[model samples]
Target: MILEVAVIFLAVLWVVTIAMFMGHTKRQRTLATQQVEADSLRDQRIRELARRLENYQGGTIRMGEELHELRATVAPLPDKITILEQRDPSTLSFAQAARLVTMGASVDELTQSCGLTQAEAQLMTKMHGNG
Candidate 1:
């Protein structure tokens, strides 16, 4: 009778051990599946970010090229201004005299302010004056 009781106890212990092992294996499988899903989500996010970075880099390159082209287009403006600055002031005075004549300035005022002769002032006034 004692032997039979020992056998039954051993059988129960063996069954319990198997059940615990199966439960632990099931839990491990569930954890593995969750890990795989998390890894997949992380990879997808990385791909999306990489795509956005590529697009931004492409836009930056285009903008850089546009800036270079604009610089090239505007590069001659300063030289043109310098050439204009180096020209004779008398030419500028003549233009100023014409403008003054259009604004109804008298011949004496044009001669004093724009360094024009009285004859030249009269001619400019005749050509450009409102009156």
Candidate 2:
């Protein structure tokens, strides 16, 4: 009968609509879960980068402090060297002459600057020169 066919068709349509709505809701839940995981990963990465930046900043500060200390320690060396140079030429040591030779001073320059004999200057040059 025409009435029975209409009732069955309406029932089938209602069932299909309910099934589609359930599928759509399941997909939405899956997408929400994925979004939550992505956000967590992003937050973790930000924390890691922040930790690394803190360590790098700490290292930079430590190195700066060390450089300042080294500068303070070395500040008086030049004045001491000047005083040594102004003292009596005879007071200059062979160690000073050797340091000059290693700095590429010629034998004559060594003899004049360090008041060494020509033989001593030549020996220092041969012992300490680059070539």
Candidate 3:
């Protein structure tokens, strides 16, 4: 009778041990699955950030090229302005006379200082007078 009781106890202990081991293995598998999912999310986010960085770099390059083109287009504007000013001495004289008129200079002063005729000086004074 004692031997039968010992055998029954051993059998129950064996069964319980196997059940606990199987439960522990299942929990390990669940934890491993969670880790894999987390890693996948991290990789996806990295890829998105890399794509954004690449697009930003491309836009920066395009803007730099456009600035270079604009500089090239505007580089000759000063020379052209100088040439225009030099080509028209009469225009310079008229501009100087107008400035003088605005500063309260009379027609005689315009004629003497800016080389304008009396009629032209009078016209400039009338057109560009401060009042």
Candidate 4:
């Protein structure tokens, strides 16, 4: 009778140990699956950020190129204005005639000081003289 009781006790103990081990294994598998999903989400987020960064870099480069082109186009304007001022004595005279006319100079004064023709002096006085 004693030997039979001991055998039954050992069998029950083995069964409980096996059940506990199986429960632990199932929980470990669930945790592994959750970790895999988290890693996948993290990788997706990283890829999206990389794509946005690439687009920003591309836009920055394009804007820099446009700015350089704009600078190059405007670089000659000041020099051209200076050249126009230096090359044409008649332009200076016309400007002087216009100024004198605004200051109430007569057509004869415009003709004498600015070397304008009579018709040109009269036209400047008509356009820029005080009303």
Candidate 5:
């Protein structure tokens, strides 16, 4: 009968529509979950990189300070040890005079700049230790 055919067709159409709606809802939920997970991962990576960058900056500052200290300890020493010795005709050898200059003016410059000897000038390295 024509009436029976129409009823069956309408029923089938209704079922199909319901099925399609459910499928679409499931896909939307899945997509939302995946988007949330991706956002969380991105945030975590950013925090990790920031921590590493801070550590690197701190290490650089410490290294610079240590280098400065080393230079200060060794650099300005020759000027401090200098003494103005007399230019006597018969004085110690050039090497010995050089040593006296190494001592922090232990022997005044006029009489004995080089009296200390080379070994003593080298020993002065201890006066200003690495610290």
Candidate 6:
């Protein structure tokens, strides 16, 4: 009778040990999953900050470049127009027209010369590889 009782106790003890081990394994797995999630969130935050910084730097460079282009484009136009307007209106020459073309003047500037229009200027400029 004692032996039978001891056998039953041993079986019960084995079952309890297995249950405790299984519970410990489950807790460890849950902890590992939580740590991975935390690490992923931190990595994503770092990447986002880096992307924002890059875009800001690119925008600054583009602004400065665009401003420089505008100043260069507008600087020489007024003097060119004044020189043309001072010459005789009826006796405008091809040399003057050619000079204006070289200086990026459009057909609008040559309005008195054979009725040149914006489309004509665009066509002439494009034909001469200037547009």
Q: How well does model 1 score by local distance difference test?
A: 0.87
Name the lDDT value of residue 79 in candidate 6: 94
By lDDT, the better pick of 2 and 5 is 2
The digit string of per-residue lDDT tens for model 1 on 15-103 reads: 99999999999999999999999999999999999999999999999999999999999999999989978877765467777777777
Candidate with best lDDT: 2
lDDT, candidate 4, 6-86, per-residue tens = 999999999999999999999999999999999999999999999999999999999999999999999999999898678
Residues 67-117, model 2: lDDT tens digits: 999999999999999997887866558898878878888988888888888
User: TM-score rank, highest first?
Assistant: 1, 2, 4, 3, 5, 6
The per-model lDDT (C-alpha) reads 0.87, 0.90, 0.88, 0.88, 0.68, 0.78
Worst 10 residues of 3 by lDDT: 84-93
The TM-score that candidate 1 achieves is 0.66
Clashing pairs in 4: none
| Best candidate (score: TM-score) | 1
lDDT of 1 at 92: 46
Q: Candidate 6: misplaced stretches above 4 Å? A: 55-131
For model 5, the stretches where C-alpha displacement exceeds 4 angstroms are 1-7, 68-113, 117-131
- Per-candidate TM equals 0.66, 0.58, 0.52, 0.56, 0.52, 0.39
Which residue pairs of candidate 2 clash?
none
